[model samples]
Target: MSPTHFISIPVASPGITENLRKFQDLCGEKIHPHKVQYPSKLHLTIGVLKLFSDEEVQQACNCLSEFSAKIPPILCEQPLHGTLKNLRVMRGDNQFVKVMYSEFILSDDSDRLQNLADKCLEFFVERGFMEYQYNTTAVKLHCTLINTRWNNAGPRTINASEILSDEFELQIFGNCVLDRIDLNEMRADKSFVAENDKRYLNVSCVSFK
Candidate 1:
């Protein structure tokens, strides 16, 4: 069977998205323009489920709905504020990087966010939706700012760390409200290029007390 691709939630907010767009613009000027990610597609991945079947995906969605209801609305009292700071690269030993991303600093109530992620992983693993052996401890909640996978402009060696120096100013991109969990798919071409509206098979929205 083919491997199924999906991203676990905590999608970005408009404020964060706007900042991501600005960063993309900056990359276009400073780094390779082709490396930037689409503003609308920017998201913080919680986890990924590989080699899932269509039925398994549906089952996972159902589980998400149940899990979402249990997660209290995160940082909803006031808009959840987070800062986009620092640039890092995920590199393979082959001398090429897999992804480039920005580290986010959640203002407060971060424990709530981490707990939610832990619960999601626990649910999936317990139900066999995700592999039991998969180490959930390693999951870092982050957003991918640049990916080389879909870049048609070809490869280029650029040190993101060098381009983004400590002197570079960081800003609070935006406020986020964790109201929903989205279930998305990866296409055969290994890209989530489908219209964002159509790509989500299910969106589990939270109902806060």
Candidate 2:
């Protein structure tokens, strides 16, 4: 496959972007953390559609358009720091200087958002599109962290005492609407670097609120 397409919500924040770039640079040059390259804009994936013919893509778009209209936009928060099993590294400042993945913070009253995701999956399934399966937790969210490797490293644990005792704020928020879906075709067989183009349907967003 050359490219692939999916429904996703991109995370854009200066704090995250700056640290992510630095982490990638360090991994690539000094630390030599095996194959830790920078990432494209981080995103929360809602769905993934297999490559389809042009006509099928058009149909998918129409369906997604209707789907978008039926749902109101969702707003959510970002994670500060959490523990995974084995990945991520901490630096001198006791900050999450290097991490493979970031968790999302969910609002307690997120039933509305969860309902929308459920309805979207039902809509796709009704249309013979069985590729829509959401996470089961009430959290009902996803995030773009680091790659799965770095088995030697475990969930990053920083020495909070060593660095600024005060908590560092590193969170971003955005309104996610079910905008247009893409019809990407993957050339590279690799899941990470599958080359593809995206024709993003109009997306509206609001920054930290």
Candidate 3:
């Protein structure tokens, strides 16, 4: 399986970078615990393919080339929500990102989101990867800024969603960079124990989308 392999997408936007800067100012010293420490570049995930042989990898890459030719990149804008209004930024089973981003401010465009995810999944399946499905409702397209341990730690003074008078402005929607895809290995020590050691491929970002 080529040791470990995956397909990944890159995500970085000016709006997002600005928001990260704001978060650093607002969050102060508490932001260092983040995996990236600070907000790194970001990207939307398209498909997840497993590792394969040289011929198989070439075949998969060919499939991706065809896919990119067919589907262009997508530019989108999503409203931002902080921990105050999102879900209190707690740490526990699948509760941090999903409970907040899923239910906060996104539109109920499950059908459309799922359709996109399914397209990615189908491509992987054709590449001989296993079939997996995530509900559009559960699909998180958000670029997170803070993820605090929800144990006995003290609460944050300000939440990302509540940065302004009422709501936080986390403008992440931008050009869909479909220029390339990357292969990343999944770490065994992820937040979710079950997802450890899982590997997949994803689309990086392109020049225009």
Q: In TM-score terms, which candidate is top?
A: 1
lDDT of 3: 0.40
Q: Give the runs in model 1 whose Cα sits over 4 Å from its true position.
A: 51-53, 73-81, 91-96, 132-138, 169-172, 188-209
**Candidate 3: where is the Cα deviation over 4 Å?**
1-5, 33-40, 72-114, 133-140, 144-209
- TM-score of candidate 3 relative to the true fold: 0.49
Q: At residue 87, what lDDT does model 2 achieve?
A: 29
Alpha-carbon lDDT, every model:
0.58, 0.42, 0.40
Order by TM-score, highest first: 1, 2, 3
Model 3 per-residue lDDT tens digits across residues 38-152: 3233433444456556766666666656665434432232212221123233234432231122112224333443344456556666656534546332334433334443223
Model 1 lDDT per residue over 1-209, tens place: 54365545554667776676676666555456556765555566666676446677667777777776566554344444556566777664324565777765667736666666666667766777665334435457776777766666756655555445666554345656544455566542334455332233333334333
Query: Lowest-scoring 10 consecutive residues by lDDT in candidate 1?
Result: 196-205
Residue 32 lDDT, candidate 3, scale 0-100: 42
Compute the lDDT of residue 48 as modeled in candidate 1.
Answer: 60
Candidate 2 residue lDDT tens string, 79-193: 2222111122322343434433353433343454445456666666577643544444222345544432433454333232322223323223232332222323322224355
Number of colliding residue pairs in model 2: 13
